[model samples]
Target: MLSKKTKYAFHALTYLGKHRDQKTVLIHDISEEYGISHKFLENILLELRKAGILGSKKGKGGGYYLIKEPKDVALSKVIRLLDGPIALLPCVSLNYYEPCAECKSEALCGLNKVMIQVRDEMLNVLENKSLADILDKE
Candidate 1:
């Protein structure tokens, strides 16, 4: 399941990307536009800034903007940042693999095998899809 936090981040980033060259957008403006809470958006922006996905300018006319182009921002990168590995089972995870507690055997586990396929499919979708691709889709 996609967390609200991640979906919100994607919405905000794509909004910023659309307006990247125009100028930065005020948090309040973005919040109202997206129907998100200002305070929540502020926190999300801070995380994005620290991640180098967003750059902020402080002052009277200050706001936020994307430091990287939309095309350069990978969906996998965002997913990893927001939700970590795309794997269903921890044991099938690439970055955080761990055997399932109830699973008596991983070698012949049908669930693990299916989960690995799920993870691969997820990677294929997210890894190949970029913010630019999504933007173009819109």
Candidate 2:
């Protein structure tokens, strides 16, 4: 399940991408446009900025903008950044892998095997999809 934070990030990002022509977009505008709480959206945008996915300006006419072109920002990267490992099982996680404490051997662990397949299938889609792809679908 996608957290409200991740979902809100997408809403804010897609809005920013669509309005790329604008030099900057006010957080209050995005907040009201999407009905997201201003404070919550502020934190999300700040994290994205820190991650280098977004850039912001201060003072008059200041707001957030995408640093990378939409096509260059992969959905998987955003998901991992905001949601941590995409893999369902810690044991099967590629970047955040940790063996199950109860499972003595992953080679014989049915859950691990199944989750690996699940993770691969998910990556097949997420890894190939980008923010541009999402914008195109809109």
Candidate 3:
């Protein structure tokens, strides 16, 4: 399940992507437009900025903006940044791999085998899809 934070981030990013030509967008404006809490949105945007996905200005004409092109930002990168590993099980995680305590061998584990397949399929879609692809759909 996607976290509320991740959903809000997506909404915010989509809004920015749609208005990429604009200099900046105020957090309050984004919150009001999407009915998201201002404080929560602020934190999400800050995180994105730190991740180099967004940039902000401090003064009157300042707000959040996308630092990278929408097509350059993969859905998988966003998901991994905000939600951690995409794999269903830690043992199958590519970046955040952890051996299952009960399992003696990952190669012999039935659950591990199934989870690897699941992770691969999920990655195929996520890694291929970008913010631009989603924006085009809309």
Best by lDDT: 3
Candidate order by lDDT, decreasing, is 3, 2, 1
Deviating ranges (above 4 Å) for candidate 2: none
**Which runs in model 3 stand beyond 4 Å of their true positions?**
none
Report clash pairs, candidate 1. Answer: none
| Residue 134 of model 3, lDDT score | 86
TM-score of every candidate: 0.90, 0.95, 0.95
Better of 1 and 3 by lDDT: 3
TM-score of 3: 0.95
Residue 98 error, candidate 3, Å: 1.5
Local accuracy of candidate 1 as per-residue lDDT tens digits, 1-138 = 878878888999888877867667898888998999999989888988888988999998899988988888889888777777779889999977888899899998998889889989988988888899978877
How high is the CA lDDT of each candidate model?
Answer: 0.86, 0.92, 0.92
lDDT per residue (tens digit) for residues 1-138 in model 3: 989888889999999999888999899989999999999999999999999999999988889999999998999888888888999999999988898888899888899999999999999999999999989987
When summed lDDT is taken over every stretch of 10 residues in candidate 1, the lowest stretch is: 15-24
| Model 2, CA-based lDDT | 0.92
The CA-based lDDT of model 3 is what? 0.92
lDDT of 2 at 97: 88
